[model samples]
Target: MYQRRTAVRRRKSRLPSYAFVLAVVSFMLAFAFPPEQPDEPSARTLPVRSLSAAACSVPPPVSQGAEPSIPSSDGEDGWMLTLVNPWNPLPEDYACTLTRLSSGHSVDERCYPDLQAMMDACRAAGLKPVICSSYRSREKQEELFQNKVNRLIAQGYSQERAKAEAAKSVALPGTSEHQLGLAVDIVDLSNQNLDSTQETTAVQQWLMAHSWEYGFILRYPNDKSDLTGIIYEPWHYRYVGKDAAAEIYRQGLCLEEYLEQTA
Candidate 1:
């Protein structure tokens, strides 16, 4: 009985010594080699992915005052070349006086006269051009974008996938040119649908051929979606001033390409 007790005590005493030795080794190892810490990113080098969803909606803040006007090689109003897209976002302070059309849709007051002239010319040509969509506020743009995302989600796309697909059709809030009051979606009065079929209408044919004359261009042309980051929207016309519009049409260049070449 005594032998058994002595053996158990010895085992218990050895355990404490073993634990103390293990702790000392651990301390020594820790002191000899400190853990390596990850390097922190500089403020300027911070990734966009780290931003919140709301921050991601609009692009990184670009100083409105600091924005350089695109060079006007042909004396086009450089301001007319303000580029807004998935990568380039509309400045937060962007403000324009809206002029409501007879159809109740509003557009930038700066482009109203040219837009009216274009519509009159189209009518004179016996083509019925109808302004179906014009300037959309950020709220309206968000609603349209969310509706598209929801539709894609209903079709079994994951949330992230749905948002990406939706962006191709409906521009996210500040990324849409419509928010600048410089873009209008015109359709045929007889067939008022926003789709590829609209491109076949007489109104689209007339506008496609002559919109540049009125300081507007077919904003999204066929096969240029890779550059525009949006689908071919034949009816969407953007007012880039007559000279720039004419140059864009002549070069068969989308706004992005035109800006890059001009820049």
Candidate 2:
């Protein structure tokens, strides 16, 4: 009877040992091979989040005495941010008070002072900044565009090809910024060609670097032709006011992009 009782006790003790061994092994296995964890989000997602946040954030108000808020087309201050492009044509009857340059090219009266100042500054720096072209009526713009297209066709291009190629240099009629009276085509007086080579002239170089100080920007920069939908025209400049010009310069943004971003 005693032997039977001892055997039972020994068996019970062995069961506890087996249970403890299994518990220990399970604990060790958990540490050795843990459950898989999900991957963290990628860094590429940061910009999207930031952009989303920025989209929802309100832009700070312009300071007192700073350039006035950009206005709609009907407002007196509308011309400052007016956009003219193939996709955005000028309205019929769109007009501005114009002041004529010595070259007989006219610009918006509001921008005349800055234009004169820019030219005077250029002269003071021993550079001759000639105003080759400025504001144009729709008729004049049509004539210019047609002339360019005709010349391209004469060069053996098809009518469709000529129109497309000509448009890179001459905006179609109402789409021209010149019609807005805020654009100017300037060239070195000594080198009076509106070609890509104009960018190498001292006057052109100076204007590109400093025109923003006078509210002008290289309207069709070589790098931004894709965005501007125009060929690189180093001789062309546009007046967008000091504040807008400064921001555009700082951001390295084309006028179209700037207007879009601000809008």
lDDT of 2 at 198: 98
Q: Write the per-residue lDDT of candidate 2 for residues 135-250, one digit (tens) a residue.
A: 99989999999999999999999999999888878898877989888999999988999898999999999998899999898888888776577888999899988777888888
Model 1, residue 208: C-alpha shift (Å): 0.5
Q: Candidate 1 residues 143-247, lDDT tens each?
A: 999999999999999999999889988998888999878899999988898899999999999999999999999999997886677899989999998878988
What are the models' TM-scores?
A: 0.72, 0.71
> Which ranges of candidate 2 are over 4 A from the true structure?
1-76
Model 2, position 189: C-alpha lDDT score: 81
Q: How many residue pairs clash in all the candidates, one count each?
A: 0, 0
